[model samples]
Target: MECDASTIVSGFVEKVVSRYAESIDRDNVAPPEFFRDAAGHGVFGLPIPREYGGWGLPFSDFMDALRLIARESPSIAHIIFVHSMSAYFVEKFGSEEAREEILPGAARGERILALAFTEPGAGSDLASIETRAEKRGDTYVLEGEKLFTTNALYADTFIVLARTGPLEARHKALTLFALDKAEGVEVGEPLDLMGFRGTGLARVLLKGVEVPSSRVLGRENEGFKPAVVGLGVGRLPFASIALGIAEGALEEAVRWALERKSFGRPIFENQAVSFPLAEVAAEVEAVKALIRRTAELHDKGENILLHASIAKFLAARLAVKATRIAVQVMGGRGLLTASKVSRLYRDAKAAEIAEGTNEVQLMIIARDLAKRVR
Candidate 1:
């Protein structure tokens, strides 16, 4: 049976997230206690195994929880997505020793995980990563820099992708290491982002950071696991977050249209205001259905690449559209920096770029379609 996460979601939102969300965005930083409080509510452990000190809920439930959190603060939800996705990688592919060492702390949110995948030269083209990990004895010395690493400021560990073989090997040359933030690991100052502001997004400099071969996730030289497995599983949950943003924006728009009167009657009564919101509402519902279906396919071990891409693509676009409409409906109030609708608009724009860009998603979908004819 699928566990419903609503109760936990409600409690966490009311007690821990609701009040501080605006401040977190305004300050462009979430307090340390916010994460701890989320941990206390089992927010971090929802999808981890019970044996690893997690609730072990289905992937769908975890996504549901994330969606609820996103409705209030997409920044916090983005943090959770990065942290949880990294944990998911470890739990699904890490060695027993690595799992035992990392999962428990991660499940408790005591040890935050940052995914160090993108580099200055390699964003969508992950196979072009230049980070090199030279094997020596039983350890590998890593030297590279990762950019836009979410959760970098608070990460206790980094799941880094580096080249382990010849450049000609391409995807086969890659390897993933669970490297601790020890000596030689430097996190740069967080970038001032237009949206998803409080996620601690920063660059990481790895200079001769050494770790045991045992720290390698999956087999050596197969770090493309993220592109093949990690992203397949990840896109749906990301779609769910976009869904939440759209839902939240749509709700705010409806409420504003109903309350804000223009020329006597409520603005909602006018077709001009209602039409756009209604269209956005329909698209939001469609995205929700797509996300749910993709999540179900994920849990069943089905091929979710195309479905996940389509869902993410549509949902992200919906988030942007919905937030734009919400802002339009609210007029000047929505433009204010302090307005929640304004904040959602900024975040929705970012959603289109994160979790794989809209263009990337279209490429995936198009390639999948092309494969059918051959």
Candidate 2:
């Protein structure tokens, strides 16, 4: 990492993040100023290359900042995820014209981007996607809807994954496009979600939306894994997010346990309360270890699909378990809307469903394992 972590945390996290996390979470919208300041500080491009006006941290180091941001405001962390992922995708797969147009401006916080991949009928089954972009002369016209498109409300650019060939073509027919919500595009209302609400989660409608032909990402009709897998997004990004949520919840539960007194003694002294918290803390450490290992493998340029799945799979479940424990430890305070644990619990539940469901991750892992077995 080029910039110091302590300084960013002091200036950004302590000064801005700590102050705004609650209000943003409550309102379900991160203010534009937050993005401006964060981008100015290079928080938006931690993993992006320096040539693109980013800090250019390795993936491992980027995880540290993501974890810190998540600990304070998971909703904002979600925003960071979308921003960094979109930037990285463009830097890796976008055409020179598209990259030059978007990345530099993105680092300046003047541009925001999101990936529109998941659909109402297509979550784990990316092949079933119905969104399509038909080519006509110099422009590609898009007509479809994207569900759970985070950051759509405020994003200036969107990298849409659409089907460009017959449905029977499956992965071979998939294509990636870089489009702007400049015209013929409609953004739905922000979802009142259980968690990650403030990150502008919403549905996007495209009715004959036109994008210049120069914006096509990667090669046409060959969008299987080449377009995204090389970036190591699902493994490190989602796993680190899970780690941050778990750590945040654990911190809250620990603080409450040690501070509140019961029966003229600290409630934390009770083995019943303390043991579970300890277990969650241990689980957090284990998840961190796994995430770090996967990150190291990623930096080494190893094929980390297996490691990523392992990390993403384990960390996701860990978030759910740790948050539930945190809420239980806080007792009645956890149930109150005013309590941070309440929000953490909700966020943790959302983690399991994001990226891919736990069952889907397991299938990937199990398939690989079975193939390698003697």
Candidate 3:
């Protein structure tokens, strides 16, 4: 049975995430208690199936929940999104034994997960990853450094991508593994980020970490497929986060416009203020429609590469635009670092960069259009 989205969203998310968003940003760390509390509320298991100890909600339901959480705290929303995405990968492609072993704990938030796909040299290009996994009898020895690993400090399990073949093989040489933190796995201190803070983002060093053959995710040397599939499916939720940012920014702007008076009248009475807010209000609905439709396609087991890209692309850009307008409406007050509008403004840029950049999304769209016309 599906968990009640309203209950979870209203009761826990608003009370906790909204209350702590500023402190989370100011301290640049989401306390462990935050995650534990979320676990107690089933926030981590919104999309996983009931048999796996999750709520078994649909993708759209999860997105609705994500949007609300992001509106309160984008950092928390992003953290949950990455964690849930890893759980999705495991349940979708992992072996039955692996699922039985990992999913229940992950669903319960007992085992936090991270994606270790990016390297210092391999950012957008997954084929050039320099990490190596050498086979030795029944175990594989992994040695590589993963960069920009979200949840690096807190993740009990990592979904890692390494090269099992020569670099000349390109994407074919890559492999995926589900690795638990061990003696050789070292996590660096969290990096100071401009936005999406408090996520425990850090670099992970794997110095000859060993894993059993059973830990391999999907097939060896064919990991690129599952990686691509997981990333593609992840874009829609990413879009939902951006939608939340836009919604939050707009809300702040509307409040400021209504309250801040200029020359004895509320600033909202001015056409300059009202028109932009009105336009963004309409745009927000458009983005919600797009995300809802894309999420519906995903629930039907349809390919969402192009549609997800569109949703992410538009939503991220709209977030930046909406935040900018909010800040402008607040005038100098919005510039204060402590202001919610300012924080939202800073956080909005990360949406465009993560889940693939706006340029990458455009390229994907262009490539799809090119193929369709031929």
Highest lDDT model number: 3
Q: Candidate 3: misplaced stretches above 4 Å?
A: none
Give the TM-score comparing model 2 with the true structure, all chains together: 0.96
Q: TM-score: which candidate is best?
A: 3
Alpha-carbon lDDT, every model: 0.87, 0.82, 0.90
Q: Candidate 1: where are CA atoms >4 Å away? A: 1-4
Clashing pairs in 1: none
**Model 1 lDDT tens row, 91-120:** 877999999999999988999888999999
Q: Count the backbone clashes (under 3 Å) in each candidate.
A: 0, 1, 0
The root-mean-square deviation over C-alpha atoms between each candidate and the true structure, in angstroms, is 1.5, 1.6, 1.0
Which should have the higher TM-score, number 1 or number 2? Answer: 1
In candidate 1, residue 5 scores what lDDT?
A: 81
RMSD (Cα, Å) of model 3: 1.0
Candidate 3 displacement at residue 165 in angstroms: 0.2
> Candidate 3, after superposition: displacement of residue 21 in Å?
1.0
What tens-digit string does per-residue lDDT give for candidate 2 at 135-171?
A: 8998888989999988998898988888889988887
Error of 2 at 285 (Å): 1.1
